[model samples]
Target: MSLVKVESSEGITTITMARPEKRNALTQELCDGLYDAYRAFEAGDDQVAVLQADGPAFCVGADLMAPPAAMWKAVPHVSHALTKPVIAATQGWVIGGGICLVMTCDLMVSADTTKFMYPEAKVGVFGGLMPGIVSRMPHKVAMELLLLGEEISVKRAYDVGFVNKVVPLGEERAEARRMATVIAQSAPLVIRTLRDFANQTLPRGPAEIFVPERYKLETIANSADRKEGAAAFREKRPAQFKGR
Candidate 1:
């Protein structure tokens, strides 16, 4: 059976990690499957994506027992380039590469029982994907997770702004899907435009912030979805955007 499952309905694509016996640990095949699944979602007509796992634990990190080369090649870094919104529904252990995966998502809904950790240091390895976590969190908090390699409670994760919402254990996936549905109802073109703009601007240093907002403005101004949105508001009806 496939380690990763991709299912689509309406405008949402759901990607599930399915390695429960091993706590959904990242194996070479699983990593490749995840990368391919994300790529498929990005290229497909899905306007939003929900990433979740089908086990007690979301992911326990990389399969350290696997060959080093396989492990290295299996990291799902492709998630970083997705243009559409990607929401993570996390529960139980989210460690090592699992933490990296959470950082890559546009939003994350973590279970109250979830425990985030970066135990790479404990295992004599450094988190190569620490940049992803550092980019999203404060420097001190990032250092704590990286240097100390301890488990972080879900409440602390939300407090530090790494997690968007903290839901009861079994409710995480439902809440994530609800959020994804809300996003899916929006104008797809505008959603992609906004995501693109944020991706381009938010990670850059002040000295590197040279891109002008006028480009996005022009794109929005010329989009049919924009005009439809205005018309719908004027008519007091919901906009029916065809992603034009």
Candidate 2:
């Protein structure tokens, strides 16, 4: 079976990591498939996308089952890999490569039975893509995750705000689908623009993000649909946005 399987229906694309026997561990094919999936999502008309895995494990991180070159190719230039919003549904062990994937996504949802860790140090290899974790999460939390490389539960992940939801085991995919469905029902461009805004702005402190935030706010606020949205809200009606 293909390491990565992508199915699009009703304007939602689900890119699933399909290797169950190996805990869906990253392999060369899987990395290639994921990279291709990202490009496809960027080009496709699908407005919402979900990155999930099948079987007990989400991903144990990048495929150690391949040549080092293959792993590096997938690792490089994927730091800010996505321009569109991507949701990650994680379960089981989300180690080295898996942590990188979750970091790249706009949102993450894990199963209550999920496990997360970064064991690269134990293996004597460097995990460079993990910087986003430090950037997004609190300092002490990121330190705890990396220093010990211990597996963390899904509830801990959600409490730390790393994941948006934590469902029962085997329900991560369903929860992600439900979220994607809700997002798909909204305006495509508007949602995407907001995603971009949040990613670009949220990382900055109030002082740091102020200027960029103002620019984005002005850009979106000046949009015709923004006016229509405001008018609709005041009128107690649904927003009929033309995405103008």
Candidate 3:
């Protein structure tokens, strides 16, 4: 079964994370699924997208025990740039990379019961992908969550302009759909032009700016040639790289 579920109607596309059992943890397959879904959405006739997740939590970030091969792929504009806008509808806890995902979206709707947190500092690991949060919300507030690793309540998130709408616990997705429908009715060319212009005006973080470069390095780092090079260095011999 696919971890990501996609549905389209009335020029609106709904992309959902469907890993309720694990609170939609970003596994390798799930990341790939999300990338593929967004890429398809970009190419399809859909004019707007609503991103939501199944289960109590929107997402719990990476599965530390079995992290994705390329978590960045799941990020908007990083791997799959979309001309159309995406709105996130979140509930429960959104942490770490989950926060990254929501922050990248053009707009967001949070459940009244939701809590946003970035615990990478407490977990003793960091992805450095969340610096873009500073561009989305207040610099100091973003830093507080990034550095102190504390939870931000839904109300505070709204006050800080992180959330566009705050609905009841189970109404996040509905609100997102309503917003998406409105956007879908707008002129596509103008919407695309505005989205493109807005993206260009925003300051990109290192992760967003160098995603392609990082992808190349990641490819080389995971290649057999890298292992062979290391072995050859240790053995004082020339490396035999097949460019695999």
Highest lDDT: which candidate?
3
Compared with the true structure, the alpha-carbon lDDT of candidate 2 equals: 0.73
lDDT tens readout by residue for model 3, 1-244: 9999999999999999999999988999999999999989999999999999999999999999888868988887677878899999999999889998888899999999789999998988777689989888999999999999999999999999999999998889888999998899999999999999988988878878788687778889999999999999999999999998
What are the C-alpha RMSDs, in order, of all predicted structures? 13.2, 13.3, 4.9
List the pairs of residues colliding in candidate 3. none
TM-score of 3: 0.87
How many collisions per candidate?
0, 4, 0
Per-residue accuracy of model 2 over 17-136 as CA lDDT, tens digit each: 888988877777777777787778778888878988888888777656562334422331252145567788887788886787776577788888788898788887664556557776
How high is the CA lDDT of each candidate model? 0.79, 0.73, 0.90
Cα lDDT of candidate 3 equals 0.90
Deviation in angstroms for 209 in model 2? 18
Candidate 2: segments with Cα more than 4 A from true spot? 67-81, 202-244
- Lowest-scoring 10 consecutive residues by lDDT in candidate 2? 72-81
TM-scores for every candidate against the unseen true structure: 0.79, 0.77, 0.87
Over 208-234, each residue of candidate 1 has an lDDT whose tens digit, in order, gives 122124324556889999999999999
